[model samples]
Target: MAIGYQSLFNDNDSVDKANTHKIYDVIIVGSGVSGSFMAKELVDAGLDVLLLEAGEFFSRTNFPKKEIDANSKLYWSGGIEFNKSADLAFLRPKVVGGGSIVNQALLDRFDDMALDSFKEQSGVSFFTKESMQPWYEKAESEIHQEVIPKEHRNKNAEIFAKGFEENNYLYDSLTRAQKNCAYEEGNDCIECLSGCRRDSKQSTLITTLKSAINNGLHMKSLFEVKNIVHKTDEVRVDGIHLKREYESFRAKKLVLASGAMGNSKLLLNSGFKKSLPALGQNFYSHPQFMVLGLFKEQINSGNGPFQALKSADPNFRRKGFKLENVFAPPVGISMLLPGHGEEHQQLMKKISHMACIEVAIRDTNPGSIKTNRHGKMIIDKKLNEEDKKRKNAGIEAINNIFSSQGAQRIIEGNLPIGLHLMGGLGIGERARFSVVTPDFHLHGYKNIFAADSSIFPNAPGINPSLTIMALTKMAASKVFR
Candidate 1:
């Protein structure tokens, strides 16, 4: 009998001494969007590749079904990490598929405004639409995408559209990376946020990762990298296996695909900041806030497709914010709403009559990432004055929409969430300001590379999953060519 897909993962017992001693062509530090696609490209070129992840690998059948279980199992810091200030919460995924596993599956390309800002900031000529079109096309070809039909729009989606129309704001349907959602069977998309049980979502674990494995790529899970030793010709990675045993591996070249926090923490912990002074600077997160509207009739926002529309207003885009129709599980909603005891219970009782809209801001200020003496990652991020102005503008627009729709009460979420994490190891022409070069290699090191959201010079004010895939595809082509 043939082994299942989960058997491809190498645990402590499955990893032999000979495999650890052998030097490979390339070793990637993450198995998320960037690393998985990069592995597929390089493996197709007949190169030996090893991909490592710090989380456990789960098959479709074994994925967490409940909201609390999924949040605790699939994310870092139990699905919510706080900065020193504790005003903002960061949801960073620590699984094999990374953010793609838990995100809303929104797929969007960067517009001219976003690309122009990036090109101007990083001095990269290829940021233009014409230059990046081929790469984006290649990335899109690897996955299936679809737009939610008008007939399937839920009450929440209808409310969003009506509010936008009544307020004269432009909106559009969202394009998602999915296969067969099976809406005819009355399946709820909110339930698939943790990990799609039906394998409908086109996450890297089901797309590029499967192809890479078939092309002879080696993958190890639950192996956390603790240190990196860069040699003249090879790179050695040392880490703990299952939190106790020591394991090390060597490769001719290494690529860091861990997100902004993971990459910054790893580099700072390994003492690379001495050589690369800007290692952890320029960190950014697209801060998002939830605004809820309570209605007299039952909206049942969580019943069907949870999200279907996004703000397409050029004015809103230029104003540094976008609105989205979204809903969460009961556990998440409870956390978002304020009050206690009977007050909280009353809100929970009206869950079926609530609709939500999220304001995602394009933050102007950048923060820094550092490590204390204990080697724990410290994230120093805050919304500057300009960011606050933009957020307030978005909130005002949402309030107008709710009032126009005759909302009984409008509630703004107290906590600000950081979902689109970017920067830290930004890429640029000058080494003084950036950690990575335009060609996606470290400034001082030639054998190490990175091309994930960590290298993004700034926020794009749009969904970044598709752009990440495109950038990594371009990186693979340029690095190998």
Candidate 2:
């Protein structure tokens, strides 16, 4: 059976071509964290599922090694999409495994503060720690997780820990979704950020999606859904294949697991805005800014684990920001590092001596996603005064950390990167404020559902990938049962 981009054009009888004619039990759009997990559950229950992805699929053997290649191939808008004002750049993944394939794999569950705020904003009863513990446990059991051993901590992590201690702040080791990272064998976690070639990151591609495929889940990559038509009994999905050929598929049920912007744009383009009034509002991205600390001695942050510690300070949490010890590839760092001409060249020369921390703000102001007259996505997101204050506080904390470690200079990144894209299709009891229901169904559609970050009601002020998986598990059990 042909399954990738090239398979869409095959003249001979292919599984994809044959499957298009028969209505599936469920057709899931976007093979990301939510889609992959949901497909696994449904397929395990013996359902005929078809998972369609707009991006290409890649195995460990074919994963891109170079930073530039991975950015262009694994991400949407070539690794940097901007809002209307262009102040914030969004790094949205467009691969089969979505953000899971490219992220650092930090797997922290939401705390009481996060869950409380979610319940307040969303009015969903299941956002509590008690109600969600079982689902979180279920999601955790599906993947391998480990805390980064202290012996594996690199100079960057040491600097972060020392700074936190000096400033009387709390910090903790990060739990990552991985198995055998082989750090003792001289393996660097920095290289896996683009897409894990060693299969240690435990992305959906290597976990849920692989299991789903074994359980009779069918996947077709490079098949973008341009429009969706809902009939009384079935939903019809139509789109372009590899941006060239037209194709359509029918299913009894439809699931949209695309990210915030993708889901909003698709629904708007398909003319569902009339019925779904709150289709593209309340969007949040945990906007992050990197601050680089230059030291006289070499840090060699890229040589070992790229990230190992995260802010666990209650004061910082109350201040609505979190700090993380992080380092990026040269290509990504160059974009964040400020300057031009000889100044930029000198900074690049000192890359080995620089350590970095990022400030991730829990933005209070919500952005909105919309489609223009030409059907192009227009993202309007900005940092309000409260969000700006939170960012400044985080940056000040980072500067203090850098100074305590005898840093010569501190430079903040010129741009904010929106890594955790959420909301837009928020889940709430009322239709006026949300798109998806607490049960994970679309407002007026019986068989259409969404279970992803797009259904987030507000920013959780923490890593959201693990919660996305847990919520999908809850959704699958509630909706499919």
**Best candidate, lDDT-wise?**
2
Q: Could you give candidate 2's per-residue lDDT for residues 240-334 as a string of tens digits?
A: 88899888999999999988888999999999989999999999999999999999999988877789999999999999999999998898888
TM-scores for the candidates: 0.96, 0.97
Q: Model 1 Cα RMSD, Å?
A: 2.3
Candidate 1 has what TM-score? 0.96
What tens-digit string does per-residue lDDT give for candidate 1 at 1-481?
A: 1122535443323322226878989988988889889989988988888888887676577778889989888898787998779998898888777888888889999999999999999988889999889999999999999998888899999999999999999999999998889888998888778888788888887888878877678878777888999998999999886789889999999999998888999999999999899888888889999999999999998876788999999999989999999998989999999999999999999999999999999988898899998899888989999999999999999998888888999999978999888999998998988898988989989889999989998888889888889999988865566
Off by over 4 Å in 1: 1-18
lDDT of 1: 0.87
| Pairs with steric clashes in candidate 2 | none
Model 1: clashing residue pairs? Answer: none
Per-prediction backbone clash count? 0, 0
Error of 1 at 405 (Å): 1.3
